[model samples]
Target chain A: MLIIHTALHGEARALINHFSLKRQHDMNAFACFRADNIFLIESGIGKTNTASAIGWACGMLNVSSPVMLNIGMAGHTACSIGECYIANRIEDHATQHRYYPPQLVDTPLGSDCLLTLDRPTENYPEKCMVDMEASAFMQAAIRFTTIELCQSIKVISDNTLKPAGRMKDSEVESLLAPHTEAVTGLASDLGQYRAELMDNTGATFSQLTQQWHFTKYQQQQLARLLQRHQALQPDEELIDTIPAWIDSGKAFMRWLDGHLNNLPVRL
Target chain B: MFSTIYVEEAVCDHPRTRKILQHFRGRTVIECRHYGELLNLKAQNFRLQKKQPALILAEKQGKKILPAPAGYHIGARHNYYFSHMLNCIYDCRYCFLQGMYQSACSVLFVNYEDFIHHIRQQALSHHDEAVHFFSGYDGDSLALEPLSLFAETFINDLRNISNIWLELRTKSTQVRSLLALEPWPQCIVAFSFTPEDISKALEHGVPAIQQRLNAIDKLQQRGWPIGLRLDPLIDIEDFEQQYRGLLQQLFSVINIDNIHSISFGAFRMPENFYNRMTGLYPKERLFAFNMERHDGIVSYGESREQDMRNTMREMLLEYVRPSILFPCVA
Candidate 1:
């Protein structure tokens, strides 16, 4: 699942239309849009709003390998207008806490450092990009997933030549329209990794427990046995080896241990 | 292969760092002032990171040589260990590295000269004692040998220090680099192994037993003395038969009389490490076994441990003399 955080409605406008996402009115704190597997949340403008929205979303959704991406417009001192750069390094000016977003997946963007500020700045710092939500978004998102699965991508809305304060909502939407395909492609690539993690794991233990009579301890043990096999044996179906007439989960585990070697070996 | 590369800013311009960075040029390079910034971070999940770990290159700033554990010595009067690297390429479940480190990312100490300097000092200071410096305690000596150039460089240097012996303990088949060089008699290429069944089940990302044996056989054919290490002997059902089969397999292929030394130990780990490993791999049956805690060490209970050792002692005596076989006892 892709949980995206955008600061402005106009920033999320292109993605909302591109993904055919429907608005969920129940989520009133933040503007939330949902599709089949993608979730985009518009946290108002500051880092606190973004962090709170991410925490709320994460508390609501329990997923195995959720991919988090923070997309917004940032002002750069030297970059050209409408240029997109992935934030490889994020620093919080308020707390001086730094977080690194690992670029493990492919994207159509180069990387630069981003300084997350408490308010907009006319004189951009030494860093290439200046944003308000990336640091907090990354700090909160990483609490849910690894550093490799999180990213902060910014489109250069303002620079030395172009100022962000002069741009309108319509202009922001128009600027983002050109890069909608790139964002979609990035999400698709991330989806492949998320699918790999989910495919390797995500086997529920209820399937075995519902049929077989077992206590709480037996159920937990059986779940670990199955999960270890999944981590070690990714290609084979561990359940297929179970005898059909096993009466208990303890017996199920004993049988599982005996056949640990039976799982087809893959190097 | 590493998905990303984390480099320390202090060693960014070092030649070893540049060499490794050349290979991973297309990948992301995150620079930190210290290696601890990435490796010692809290809330980092080792299990999740193990799916795709990054490589961290840093400089070793402090003492490089350390004393080996009391029972860890093979046949030396003074045993020491130095780690040019912090982690291994293979993911054996029995490895203590998983339980000891918070992250799965491998840390390569790029300063090989510092390690060499300390080793020479330790050997010269204890010239009367027969010191055996062991590599691959923190990481497999040969697994990262190609990238680090540690084994080739150190072996050439240790040729002058006759008082100190070098042990390159590994389970890696990346021995082609070493094969091209002259075989030093004082350096023992120790290869560790478990039974075929246990190895296949628990040893992840390692070569097959036969392939490792082939590497050893090639090394021995060139007149390099080979050592056998069967450590952390796992206790399982029909333990006698399984262990006997493994020893028989070892003696059949290699010349037992020509072997440098053989060592074996029971499966045991520190209490904290055992608890941490169990948390990372709660479903692993290896940790779930009924373990006993004596002082700070956790292992199979006394009676079961003795029984396994008795079987090992009897089987090992059949091929080699008792002096050559070192069973690490607590």
Candidate 2:
């Protein structure tokens, strides 16, 4: 699954309309949309809210290896308004100022540190840039997916010294419109990368399971056991199932042991 | 819970060591020459070691006890805490030790006598005042009591000191030693608890909530002073209801008169520690909270934190007196 979280409603609205038919659910704060091969989430403002929304979205969708993109507007310290930069690091300015290190997006748009503050960086300093929700969204989303799938793209809506609140809703939309095509193209590329990666990993697991050399009946039994393991909710039910699976496996191994012993003398 | 004994050569041949080493069979003995060299070494991953951590038995050289963290004490004039051991047996996913330590190995400073002597000196310094000495700050107090004999030795040593108050904070249900001892008025056997659902989800290797409560009831009946710590309160969907239910269930069975203190704190961690922990378990659902880093502390955002604290405080106040309540700010 692919998710795109945005800070402002207008920016998300443009992408949502552009990818309208691909949209899955509009749960007010976060809108879930599909863009060709990717699933997207337009997460609302601020680090804390965005983190919670992303977690909820992951849980609701049950997407294990999702490609998460925080597509939003940010105030840049060095750049002018209306310019776009793909972030290499997402820094939580309020907390220990730790940075989420760079990942797969090797774009010349350059690396900008996104400061996710509890409140908007109203008194934006020359050295510090401000964003509403990228850090928290990235932190939470990264847990559900691998490092390669986690990406953030921010368009500069204001200069460092200026407040992010001053940027009009329409102005934010206009700044992001031109990059809408670029963002969609990037999303499609990411989805293909993720699909290929999944297929490769799945193929490896399949090969390993096949090399174990179980009969058809044994394979069916193993599949049934794994399904039961996944389906059970209560701790006791799951714990109880483990022993049965283990006992069955052991019993099969014992039978195989006798059969192998009887035929091995020919060697 | 452990079957092997890892010893530093400096204290391996000590007189008291022979008795402790004889207990475990199929023991693999590895010798290290120094404690300081191994204990503080970097590149040893704390998270991975937790899976099957070894126990390190070493002697503590100096400064056995230290002052507690700021805003950590409650209802005491001089607050101090000492760890006879480092690293917990239970692997709670949210524990800071996983991020703080270079290794997950449990370092048990076998010099229990030295720790007691220092604690005694601190208590005597404040003769008339109620001096509180907390144990299990770095690790659970009674989790490995069977092997370490920590609670047994400390209980005996503390009996001589009249003014000193000891708080043995633990999440372990291994209260065999505690139940056997005649209860001391100055000693508070505290149990840290959370909602059952949360415990099951995150508190791996810890005894169930029901089991802990049963142990508490047994200890209380034996006349031991009990304390309840609901620290690092997790943010769940129906958090208020969950906490309320926990408080009600505890109060229903526990004797309120014997309750020493009830404390609660919102989930918070140092930024670096949180970062390390996140790196260790990149796919953990618990780290995916709506958290904010404010003034070097990472926690749930302000409004949500305040709401949780106020609501939990109100619920706790309903059953316990205000004087017995403590809010852990650190």
Candidate 3:
């Protein structure tokens, strides 16, 4: 699942139209749109708003292995206008602390350092893109998932030649319009791969617990063993090898250990 | 090829960094104050990142030399290990790096001068003894040789140090750099190997065994001293035939006297590393072997280890002298 957090309505429009998303419940505090497993939320235009939108999405969303992406405009000192770049390094100007979001894909769009500023300004001291919400979004998002699963892409809306204040929504929409297919394709690929990894195990612990009583540690150990078996022998069915009725959880674990012991230790 | 590059701000303008940057111009490059901020972050899926690993160019800080682990040596009393790079290009399923490190990105510490300085100091400190220095401990010494040119550059710096021995342990067939230069007298290019079938199954992305043997033969013909490492011996169904065949194949390639040393050990790993590796590659037959934890370490059963060792030792004795044999108990 891909949950895109955008700052402006135009940023959401390009992707919404590209993915054919529908408006879901106008009564919500934040604007939410959905298409299949992908969702987009417009978070006003500040750090606080970005965090709020992420929290609301997490609480209200349903699914597994959510791959979050934040796309919007950013100001750079040297990069050409309309150039889209992934944010590999994100820094908060006030805190001076930095965050590195993992870049797993190799896309047509290049990447650069991003600086999240408190207020908009023309002085782009360093060769980095200046934004307002990426750092906060990253800070709050990491609490939910890993650094790699959360990615950020920014379009160079303003450079030294073009001031950010002069930028318009239609310009942002047009800039993002051409790349919607590529962006959605990237999200789908990454999300599906991550989801498969999360679901590698054959049987869930909850399902096994219904038939047998197990300690917390036992559950963990059994889960790992089953996961290993599932990964190694994906075509085999775990239930096929089991007795019609498992008398006890401990006995079942013992039987599994003995069964695993007889297999070839090395190739 | 790397999809992204994270360069340390301090070394952003360094010549080595510049060279790498120019070579990887099409890559997405990002600058950071330090490498650890990107390389050492927790919860990174090593298995996933390894699919398209990035390259991190950083300036190594602080101590550049450290004493080698107790059992890691080849006849020298004064032994040390230094890493110019971390992680590796080849993804051998039995590798400990997957568990030892949380991230799979290859970090090349471009400050080779510091490592050279430390090596010179260690040599000067032990002037009477042969201070043996080891490379490729954390990563392959030659796998990235085309870009790194580490051996070519590092050997030049070690020209003045006469009382030290350098060991470049690797499984790569990248001996082109060494073949082009005059072999350093005390330097030994050690190659690690397993049986063809076993290696083909577990050692993914590595060069074929015959290719490595050919490299050893070429280097030996160049009058460079060679070393054979049959370490981390994995158990297979046909052990007697496999070990004997491997030993025969090795001896068929090079003169036994030209071989500097030989070392071997059973597959073993630290407890934490074993747990992590199993988690990463839960389906791997290497980890699924009959292993037990003793004194906070996981290893093949003692009897199984000793059986394999004695069998290989007997076969090895048919070719090499006993003095050059070092069975690593650790």
Candidate 4:
């Protein structure tokens, strides 16, 4: 699942239209939209609202490890007005706590440092991208998933030449529209990576549990044995080879271990 | 090959840090208060970061020199180890670093003078006894030689210390720096090896067995003392034939007199480290073996461990004297 949190309606409009997301009427605490596996939350501006919305969404969705993204606008010192960048470092202005999100995927977008402030700042003193929610989004999202799955994408809307007060909603929508495909592409890549890591383990465990009455400890052993079977003989199936005489989970586990130990160590 | 470099504020202006940063001229250099702020973050995956690890330059504070592990010794009564760097370049599946560290980025403590000062202090305290100092405990000693210049600088500093012994334990074929300097009498260049099939299956990014043997042959010819470290003996189906063949190939190339010491140890891991390693690579067949836990350390039971150790000991005795063989058991 991919959860995207945007700070304004203009920032969320292009992604909502691109993914064909509909308003989720049941959610009352935050404005939410959803499609098949993608969710968008239009959180109000600032760090507190962004963190509150993320916590609510995590509780409502109940996902163990969902890929999360925060897409919005940011101000830079000298970057071009319409350029897009993914944040490699995020720092909270109030507390000065910093977070470095590891870049693992191959993407065409450039990366920059992001500074999350309590309010808007017109003076671009440092050579860093300025925002209002990336730091809190990362701090909240990593509690539910790994760092590689939590990321932030920002479209440059204001710079030193053109201050923040001059930017309008339509201009924000236009700036984010061109980078919707890139943002979705990154979320898709992370979701696929998570799926590949989770695909093979649970299916075999469910198959074996239905065939025998396993004690609590026996269930853990059964899961480990099934994992070893999948690692050593990936193409072969072990569920169909169980004999009818193995009545208890203990006896079944013993039978399974005998088979796994006999397989040749390929190295 | 790193795309990013993180520099601690303390060492950002150090001469060694500045010199090393020259090599990576155009890469992104992010400054942090300490290296642990990024490397010790929660939710960081070791397996994911290993693909594109960044380089962290920092100062080694606190205790720099300490006693080595109980069995990790050559022949000295007082043995200690220090790490000027952390995390190896190679990604061996059975390495304990994956379980011990949260991040896979390599950290190079650019303050080499501080580590040297600590080594000198420890050696002075144990002046009466033959003191041994070991490197590559947390990382490889020579794998990043060109970038760190660790071997060349340390060899020059400790050349004339008669009571101090230095051991560079590594599997890297990075021997150009060692070959350029005269061999130190008290230093031993230790090379680690497993069977070819096991190396192919487990040790990723390590040089081939023959290439490593060739590198050792060159060092031995230059009058450097060579140590054979056949550690963490992996359990395989054809254990006898595989290890016997490996020992035979090693003994054929180098002169017997140059063999400083030979050590063999069975595979073992602290129970918690084993659990974390299995969580990182659940599909790995190496962790799927039926292991027994005793005293919070997991190993292939006592009978299996003794069998492997005794067999390797017998095979090694065929090539070197018994006085030079050490069996490390923890």
- CA lDDT of each prediction against the hidden true structure: 0.82, 0.72, 0.84, 0.88
DockQ of each: 0.18, 0.01, 0.47, 0.65
TM-score leader: 4
Query: Candidate 4: deviation at residue A248, Å?
Result: 3.7
The C-alpha RMSD of each candidate to the native structure, in angstroms, is 4.9, 22.2, 2.4, 1.9
Docking class of 4: medium
Q: What order do you get sorting by DockQ, best first?
A: 4, 3, 1, 2
Give the per-residue lDDT of model 2 (tens digit) for B240-283: 87888898888888989989988888889999999888656644
Worst 10 residues of 3 chain A by lDDT: A196-205
Between the candidate structures 1 and 2, which one is better when assessed by TM-score? 1
Candidate 4, after superposition: displacement of residue B264 in Å?
A: 1.1
Model 4, span B1-330: residue lDDT tens: 677899999998999999999999977788888889887997877887787788899999999988999977889899999999899889989899998898988999998988988888898898768999999989999998988999889989987777889999999999999999999978899999999889999999999999999999999999899988999899888999999988888888978899899889999999988988887787899987677899999998889999999999999888888999989886
Q: Write the per-residue lDDT of candidate 3 for residues B112-154, one digit (tens) a residue.
A: 9889998999899997689999998899999988888899888
Kindly report which residue pairs in candidate 3 clash with one another: none
lDDT-superior candidate, 2 or 3: 3
Q: Give per-residue lDDT, candidate 1, residue B6.
A: 83
What is candidate 3's TM-score for chain A? 0.88
For model 2 the local lDDT of residue A261 reads: 29
Which DockQ-derived CAPRI band holds candidate 3?
Answer: acceptable
Q: Best by DockQ, which number?
A: 4
